[model samples]
Structure formats: structure tokens, C-alpha cells
Target: MAAIEPEATGFEPESAVRKMSGFSLKPAERRALLTILCALLAVRILAMFWYPFVDSTEARYAEIARKMLETGDWITPQFDYGVPFWGKPPLHTWMSALGMKIFGVSHFGARFLFLIASLGLLAVCYVWVRKLRGHDLALVAIAVMASAGLFYGASAFVVTDMAMVLGTTMSMAGFYACLADKSSHRVWGYLFFAGLAVGLLAKGPVAVVLTGIPIFLWVVIGNRWRQLLRLPWITGTLLTGLIALPWYLLAEAKTPGFLNYFIIGEHYKRFLETGWQGDLYGSAHARAKGMIWVYGFIAFLPWVLFAPALATRGRQVLEIFRKDRTGWHSYLLAWTLSPLILFTPAANILPAYVLPGIPAAAILLVSVWAGIFGQPGRKTRAWVAVSMIGVAVVVFGLTTVAFFFPNTLNVRSERELVQKALETSPDIAINYWGDRSYSAEFYTQGRLRYIADSATLEALKSNDVRDALAVYSHDIPRLKDRLEAGFVDLGRFNRRHLFVEPPLQ
Candidate 1:
């Protein structure tokens, strides 16, 4: 497992960046590029503060991290007060907790690490692609990634997909570096393994499957199987084990049977079984198999629309695939297709499942365009500059509007209802009936309570908690009737009603 000098990965050294690449940008283009970057940066910062925390997903993760911060238990992710969450590893929660510690427990703090991971992923893409392709193509790819709808949205959200993408992309890029530059073998080899470790922490075996399988398949197809021996697998494996295993082992030791649920129930059955009955924490989506393929286009929106333009380069792309000895096309194809292939037969699917491969798709799209068009001429540069500025403007305006707009979309109604309850009775206990809102828990600092049934509501009616706040849907006839009798109607938000008991004294 010693670091052996690996054979060429079919990449050629790129030349110095030219004027069109923005390395030494022309006056107008430089101003334009600077404006675009500044605009994007401003919008991202504004989004951090302006956007509402989404329910069921974003708020769930933020609450778990908040709970971790609250209870001082960093090992097991807590779904409720004492309920252990085995849905994902603690890496994401741990990162957010650290963010909360630094920035205070708030929405921005919860998503801070995710935003950093997204930016780091982009930086990695820029450096890696710049080394393989010329500066112009690298910049194009980076621009496309930054402007892509899903990538842009995922960048600001508190989700595991961005962290997962960071790990997988880092691992793959490191491998590419090892193959592309023999002199950098030790550095890139170690990076590859380090990323593998990160990926494991990010999403468990699925990371290995998504990343390792693609590299393995590409090597086999390219007849470069022997290159595997050249990698520092022994050291790499040890490093990965050191970083990823201790958490899993410690979590299992703390909570017996965690490993069983996480690995088998979450990883296996959740994917293979439609409406998976084994899921202990939540129900499965059970979308038709291969829906991920369709989601790919949606996730790659605005850019995927350019597929027709890219289609004209089919002969060029095919030739690159058939003739390129550097394995560039092969590696990209593998990277892009790996997740789609793996998830194609799965019962449950989400756009985030295809996230790790998005960077690859963007890179591939730009590379094909670069291959066909060669360097950008004056007209092309002007168009590129305009497009970059225009997209940035649109994204900034869209985010601004989304922020100022009311939560009429119903997306934030649950949060609004919870807020209303809190506003109604700050001194009394604020609770919900019928269901729970994790977002509410996050906003209330985990003080929100749930009244499960009529029995609980009846018991609470006479309890010393005079003028307590409660939130429930008006459609729940039983709960509604009981609420009206004991609690004065305060107000309404969306379909949920806010009530204050004892007629507010």
C-alpha cells in the first residue's frame, strides 16, 4: 500500500489562463465579473438572515443541532427530548452545533456550516477543474454551478447534501489529481482517503458506494485496474477508519441497537422497500423507482435547458469518450451517472440524492461547450459577461422577493402558528395539538409541547396553566370543540387556530 507512482490519468497540463478566462480580465469584463461576484455574495448574505427555516427538513436538522447544544450530548442526535435519531450521522449536527456555539443558536447559526461547506465545494471545483481544463472552462463550470437553481438553494439550507457533496467531490477530485499529476501523488492520495473518511461521516456506506464505485468502474473500464495498487490504500483505509468509525462505535455503545437501525433500517430497507414499514422514525415517500433520473433535470434547472445546445456537440463528446486517453470524459461520465444508476431502482428518492453528482454535471456541461467553441472571442466574452451579471441580478431579486413576501405559500404557516401561540401567551405554556412543528421548537428554543389527544387536552383544561397558549387546526372537530369551551379564540394563522385559556383572565 505504499504510494506508488501512478500512470497518467489521461489529462494534459493546462496552459496559463488567457484574458477571456478573467485571470487578467479586460476593463469592462473585470468590472462586470466583480459586480457579479459581489452581487452573489450580497444575496447569499441576505438570504442567511431573510429566509425562513423550512419545516420537516431544515427545521428538523436545526432543532437536532439545537438540542445537541441544549443537552450537551454530542454523540447521539436527539429528535425529541430523549428520543434518539438514527436517520443520519452526527457530522452535520455537530457542525451546526459548533456554528451555534460561535454565532448563537439562530437560523443563520444553524445553516452557517452548510454555507461554508458549499463555498468550499465550489473552491475545490475551481482548483481541480482549473488544473485539468484551462482557466476559462473552469470559470465557466464554476459560474454554471453557482447559478444552477438547486446548487444555489442547497448552498444556504441546513441539509446533509451539501456536506455529502463536499466529501464526494473532494474525494473524486483528489483521485483525479493523483492520476493527473504523479508528482502530487502523496498529497492527492492522502486527500482522497481523507475525503473518503469525510464522506463516510457525512452519509455512511452510501458515500463509498457513490464515490468508490465510480472510480472502480472507470479504472476497470479504462484498463487501469493496476492503478489501484499504486494508491495508499492501507494508510488511506486506516485514516478513514480513524475518522469515521469512532463516532459510529461510540454512538452504538451509548445507545445499544443504534447500529442496527442506522445501517439496516435506514440504509437498506429505506431504499429498497416502498413505503418501508421498517422505518421507525418517519414514513417513506415511496416514489416510483428511477424518479431520480427525472429529478436530475429539475435539479439542474436553467443549465439543463442548455442540453439542446450541448446536443449539437454529440460527435465531439463521443469522440472524447472513445479517444481521450486521459480518462477525463470517462471519469466525469462515471461521476455523473454513478448516483443515478445506484438510485434508479430505489423506492424512495429525493433531488438531494443526486446532489453529490451535480458538480460533475456542471463541469461536464462547461467542458463540452469549451471543447466545441474553443476560446471565447469578443462577442462570446460579452455574452458570457452579460449572462453572468444577469443571472446574478435575477437570483438576487428572486431571493429578495422571496424574503419580503408573506408566508402565504403555506410553507411557513406552521412556524407562523407557533409564533402566534407564543405571542398570545408568553408567560404560559405554549403547546400544539394533533401534530408537532420542529420549526416551532427551534424558534421557541425547544420549549414547545404537544397535546396528543382529547384526553390530554381535557386534562390540560383544568390544569394550573391558566391562559396557556395552544395551536391546532380548525378542522379537528374534537380538538376544536374542546379548545373553544376551555380556551378563548385568539387568532388564526393558515389552517391552525391560536387559543388562550381562561379567557385571558
Candidate 2:
């Protein structure tokens, strides 16, 4: 992708009021993007406390990090006391553990690193796009991304996707810099490798695939086979290997057979095999291949409403399917489309899996917006305001539900149950049977334990551990006999129930 010389375009608008897609830039464009970014962050920060840790994902990650802090074992993330968490590398856990150490093991602390990564991603996207596309488009890109529901959601949410997105953004930006600008400095090449290293630590080999495949496709399509030589491959590979290999080696050494489980089971089988039957630590999502694109619309949110405008670029979009014009448009298309293609056949696809492509999607939208509204004196300001208002309405509606009527959001009730259990027996350990809530483990600072069935639970009650609290859901009716014989009811909240052995007189 070659940069179009500014002289050839003859459209050098003044910085003070650059007209884009018929909308005036009002000199405060940079401030507007920043203001939007800040507002998005404020909403997410509010959400950190307003919502409980979502179980099976957010709480799971936070609990593992808490255990890492507790045991002082930084090498291996722990799902249980001795169970090595093989799902992901420990980079996120390391950052989260440090946050827990500083902020205390709470939701804010657990999510602090993701917040920073999200901000870093914003900064990187703005800087990188402004460098290539210009300040106006860069500002629009940031504004569009900040307004996106998934991109904004991941900012304060406890997830590894933002970290991965940050790395992918850097890697793709660096590649764009090197490939599009023949005179690009050595730093761009270095940033490319740095991104690879960070991405490897962030999400393993999947990062490499996500970063490498697009570039490979772009180079082959553009016939810039020579551009490959210009990159410092040997040095970059060495740098990436040096930065990324140690932890993997250490993890494999610490936990025998970790490589097979993480690499083959998680990376390979998870994508290729429906349901990922090989998964050891977690269940596979197992959705239809088309759901990846369906998630794309949801992930991009209000921007996807501009589908008609995008369809006008139908020929350009199809160019990604074959060798075509070699320019920033093609690069953006490759960067945006590759992920959809890569994940289309995946057995377990997540909305966040498409996050790496979001920056490119935002860029594409900005390009389309600029083209469609490029005519002078087009009153687009009101439309932009309407878009922001729509976002605000959605955000306000969600926050209201979270704050005023939390129980209505049953997806997060597990953590509320755990919080109730802790309120009753703050000093006693909590144990559950039938089902385990990761939120309980996190809220309890990893003190939540599990037993197999009524017999094991009764054995604990017969011992001095009788003071331990037993927590479960409405499913506790199945264990009515056990509860009647050995335990006294504590309380019930929503669908959750709590029980404890009677105190000796």
C-alpha cells in the first residue's frame, strides 16, 4: 500500500477548519476526539463498580491473578490451587496481579491493566492513523472507535482481547509504515517486531497468524515481493523470539505437557474442531462459522448502521478477494477482512476475536464517511451529534439498568450470590457442590472451594470445618435431604441459597 502524495491530491485543507465529508473540522477536532475518548473511559470506569464480575470469564481471569498474587507464583496462572491455567499466557495475569498488589484484589484492580491497554490502544491508533491518513481522518478513526460498543466495552472489562488488540494494532501499523513508505525509518520496522513479541505474550501463536497472514496476503497481491526483503526479518525474528520465548519455555518446564495442551489443544483444536473437544480447562463456544461476521456487526455497533455507504464500495471490498490496486485502501481491506476469513471456519468464535480488525474497520468507515460527505456545505454536524446522542442514550439506559435493577441482569447474578454468602460468613471458607461460580472464588479472594457431592460436604461438616459455609443455587432443592439433616439455612438471594452447620451449644 503506497501513500498518495499530498501534492497529487491538491486538497490540502487548512488545519484550523479542514472540511471532511462535508463536515467542518472546527479546529477543535483533536479535542473532540480526546473528549469522546475521555467520555468513553468515564463510562467504563463507572461500569467497573456498577457491575459485578461476570462469571466464567471476568471472575475467572481475576481469580487466577489473585491466586498468583497469593502464592507469589508468577510463572503459572492458577485456576485452582494446583491446577495450571493453560488457556492463556501469564502476561495479563502478571499485569492484573500487580494491579491487585497495588489497588487491592477488587474489580477495579483486576481491570486496571485492561484500562491502560485500552488507553494505550487509543493513543497508538490516533498517532499511527494521523501519521498515515492525516489528522482529520485520525480524529474520526478515534471517535468512531471510542463510540463502538465492543471496543468501548473491552476498555474497562477484564479481558485479554484489548491487550491482543493493542499488539495487533502496533504490528499492523508498523507493517503499514514500512510497506507504504519506502523512506520509513528503522523504528517502524522495530515497532513491528516489538508488536509481535508483545502479541505473542498477549495471546500466543494466534497473534502471529493474525499479524502475519494479512501482510502475506497484501504482499502477494501487490507483487511487492521485494518489500519483504526491506524489513529486518532476521533481527526482528530474533528480537521477537528473545522477548516471547522465555515465558513459554519456563511455563512448559514448570508444567509438564503444557505446550501440547496450550498450543495444540487450545490454539489448533479450538479453531479447527467444532466444540473443541480437546479443550482441557474450559468448554468451547461452538457457534456456526457465520457468527463471526454476525458478531462483527454487533461489535462495530452504530458504525455498522452505515452498511449502505459501505456497500457502495462493494467493488473495493471485493478487491480483497484477489490481487488489486496497491494502496492504503487495499491494506485496510486486507487488515479488516483477513480476520473475518480466518475466523469464519472457527469452531469457537468470540466477538472479541474480531477486535484486532476494529481499528482498520474504523479507518475504513472514516474513509467512507469522508467520501460520502466530502462535498462542501453539507450539514453533517447534526448527524454526528445524533450519533453521539444515540450512543449516550444506549449508555444511559444500560447504566440505569445496572445501577437500579441489577437483578434483572441475570447474567451477573452469580457474583451477587457470592457477595451475599460472604456477607453472612466473612470468616469462614465457602464450599459449593454441583456447580462452582468463579465469581465466588474472586470475591472471596480465591477462598471459595468445591466438594464432589453430599457425602464430601457432610464429611467436612462432621469435622472441625463444619463452620465452613455451603453455597449453591436454586438447584439446592436436589440436596434437600442433606441440608435438612446436617445444615441450617442462612439466606437466599435471587436464585442462590446459603447453608451452614448449626453451632454447638
Candidate 3:
């Protein structure tokens, strides 16, 4: 007995038991995790590939990126008409350009990079939730985010929003790592690098604002204020400048008023001025009082049912402050509230503008779910069922709306028509009216020469009529004035007026 007891003493039985427990993975749990990730990805891919690109801005962005690839000019982004356009930063264009290069410039090819970026976002969210809450909550957060209508829409399109979301989420994940793990200096490096890279690639300095402010506030409130100085602020700032400055500099040199239009006009004026014109947003789109709440409700659907529980947890965090005044909960509150306050005052607001807040919302949701339903039960099952149904309805509704009531005249659908019209009448140079000019260029793969405005029309009038097709929106009659004298109407197609130049009289 004494010898047996000595042998047992070589390793503590409790320690051995605990170590063994860590290695155990139940078959059912593994199955559940795989099933959830696969299902979420399936739904996302289906919705993304199901519809062709929509007209106006979405198609325009993709077309511009395609041109960038075709021309081999990454410095200056161009529309179909070859004008120096700088409405948005070049990160999205760069990504799309790469996609075009790899995938050969189809709609799917142009949007492929964004799709990959969206998947990166999903992967980041899963890792982030697992680190912050737990594995179970990570699954729920990812599923909810992947299925949300807005998220799905953003993911499917080749717009800047998805890039912004992916970059911002990466910054947040890096920031969280910095806060959670103090012993590792690499964590702060990751945070700084992510912030800088994302800032460069996404939305300029605003990316840093969206990411840094919350982190700063969290550190200060957590009584880790001094830790701020520990981060490599100077190096990080320099790095960010290095990454972001070249594009702006090159763009400014190539295009006049680029800085003013992008930084001051688009970013600043759009936020402060109510009636800022153009496709960005206007008074009609701005609903300050109710839009955030509505967006909040919609963005966090199914999971929003746990908001009351989060409120309760927040109250508990407040009470804890009364006693100890130091905890992660305070940091969570800061992270959640800061961005909401910052973006709410902007003159132009879209639901996607608040995407950076999704991570915080996910964290809060996980916290509430953990507090209320710590273990599986009837309540948990009910919550899960309701969430699944809510997400299903949103996904189905979006698919129905996008596919059945398609905007056929949009840049996406009308591209081929423009191409055919151009090829059919190659003797005359085509002039495009309204926004269709950009899509026409994309469809022709930049081969068909196009002129913008009456001046270009006047210059090109002497060109052979058979080489050109004039396309104008049905709504605008002034474009008809630019048509050459002998041009004949080629009949209307897809709500666009096409004119063909006749053979010389």
C-alpha cells in the first residue's frame, strides 16, 4: 500500500484528470461546429452568386476596377469615358483589379476578391468570438452575421463596404488581442499594423478613428490608461502614413481637386451637410432619430432578442464599478457606445457605415446569451429556433426582391447590349449619356471608343458613323442633340435609346 501511494504521488491525480479532460473532444460537439460553419458558408455563397450586379454604383465600381486591370494603370482609376474620376479610394479598386487579373474580368471575376474578403471577415469574426466569449457563442455570432440581410448584401457586392468591414474587423481583433494579453508585445504590434493597413485599404484615417477611439477609451476606463503610452504610437502613425500617402499623392498629382473632392467634399461635407448631392446620400436618406435604431434592429436580427439581457449585464457592470471600479465590462461598454455616438451625427448615414460596431454587438450578444442561458434548455432551443427563422425570412426576402424585380437597364445587364450596339455600328464613335457610359466601356472591355459631353461629341462627329452607337437614358433628351446628322435610331432596348450612324449619304 505504501509503495502504491508513493507511485500515485508522482503525478497528482487531480492534475492528471484535468489534463486528460482538456484533450477530450466529444463527437457531437465536433459535428455541431462543422455543421454550423458549413451551413453558414453555403447560405452566403448562394445569395452572393445568385444575382447579377445591380446598376448605378455597384456596377460602376466593378467596371472601374476592370478598367484598372485592362489598362495596367493602378495609379489612376478611370470610368469608361477615360475621365480621371476619384469618388472613392483605390483599395477596393486594387482588390478588384487583382481579381480581374486572376479570374479574367467577368462579373464573377471582378467581384471575386470581395467575396474572398467577405470570407476573411467571417473567419475573423469566428476567431474573435471564440477568444472573447467562447466556442459556442462564436458559432452563433458567425451564423447570425453571415445570414443577416445587410451583411449578406455587402458580402455579395463588389463595393467598398465589404472591404471596410473586413479591415475594421481585423483591427478590432488585433485591438482585442492587445488588451487581453499584456505579456506579449507582438499583440500591440499586430494592433498597430492592422490599424494602419486597414486604414490605408479601407476608409482612410476614419478607419483608425473607428478602431482607435474605442480602444483608447477602453484602456482609460479600465484603469490601464498608462498602457496607452506603451503602444508604438509614432511608429504606427508613420507606418499608416507610409501605406496611405502614396495613393493619395499619386492620385492628387494625376487628377485635379482629388483631395478636395475625396477628403473635404465626400468625407467631410457628406457628414456635415444635409443636402450633399450625388449618389452618396441626401436628406431623403438621412433619418437621424430612427434610422440607427432601425438599423440596429435589423443588423442584429434574431440575436437582438438578447439585448434586454445585455442591458441587465450592463447594469451589473455598472454596479461592479461602484465596488471595484476595474473590469473588462467597462471596456466593453466603451467599445459599444463610442462608435455609435461618433457616426450618428453624420449628415449622410447608411446602414453599412456602422458595420465596425458589429463586433461589439456580437460581444454584447454573446455575453447576454452566456448570462441568461448558461446551459442548453427549452429557452435556449426557442431562442435558436427564432433566430433561424428570422434569418431565413431575411435571406429569402432579399433573394426574392433582387432576382424577381431586377433592374434590367442597370449597368450589369445593359453592358452586353452596349457592346453589341457598339460592334454593330463601328464606323461612328459612340457617345454615352448619363451613367451608362461607364458600363458601356466595361462591357466593351475598353475597346470601343466613347466620348463624354458635347465637346467630345463635336470632335468625334467626323468619324465614320458605322463605328459608333450613341446611348442615352430614356429620361434625358439633351443627349439626343449631340447625335450626328445622319445617325439613325437603332430602336430602343432595355430602356436605353441606341442610335446608329448611317452610311455616308
Candidates 2 and 3 compared by lDDT, better number: 2
**What TM-score fits each model?**
0.91, 0.89, 0.75
Model 1 C-alpha lDDT per residue in residues 59-87, reported as the tens digit of each score: 88889999999999989999998999988
lDDT of 1 at 427: 68
Poorly placed runs, candidate 2 (over 4 Å): 1-24, 28-33, 181-184, 312-326, 375-379, 464-474, 485-491, 501-504
Q: In lDDT terms, which candidate is top?
A: 1
lDDT of 2 by residue, 1-505 (tens): 4433323322233443244224335566456646766666677787776767777788788888889999999999988899999989888888788888999888788888888887888788887766555677677777788778788778777777788888888898887676545555356777899899888898888988998888888777667676666578889889888989999999999999999988888888898888767776678998987788988888888888777865887775555333323356677778887779889989798888888888888887776566554531224545554665577567766866866666675555456556656565566657776567777777777676788766776676567654544555656768787777877786764456677666545
Ranking by lDDT: 1, 2, 3
- Give the per-residue Cα lDDT of candidate 3 at 296: 60
lDDT of 3 at 489: 76
Model 1: lDDT of residue 32: 63
> Across residues 281-359, which tens digit of lDDT does each residue of candidate 3 receive?
2132555633565676676665676667657677654554444322334445555565566667776677776666766
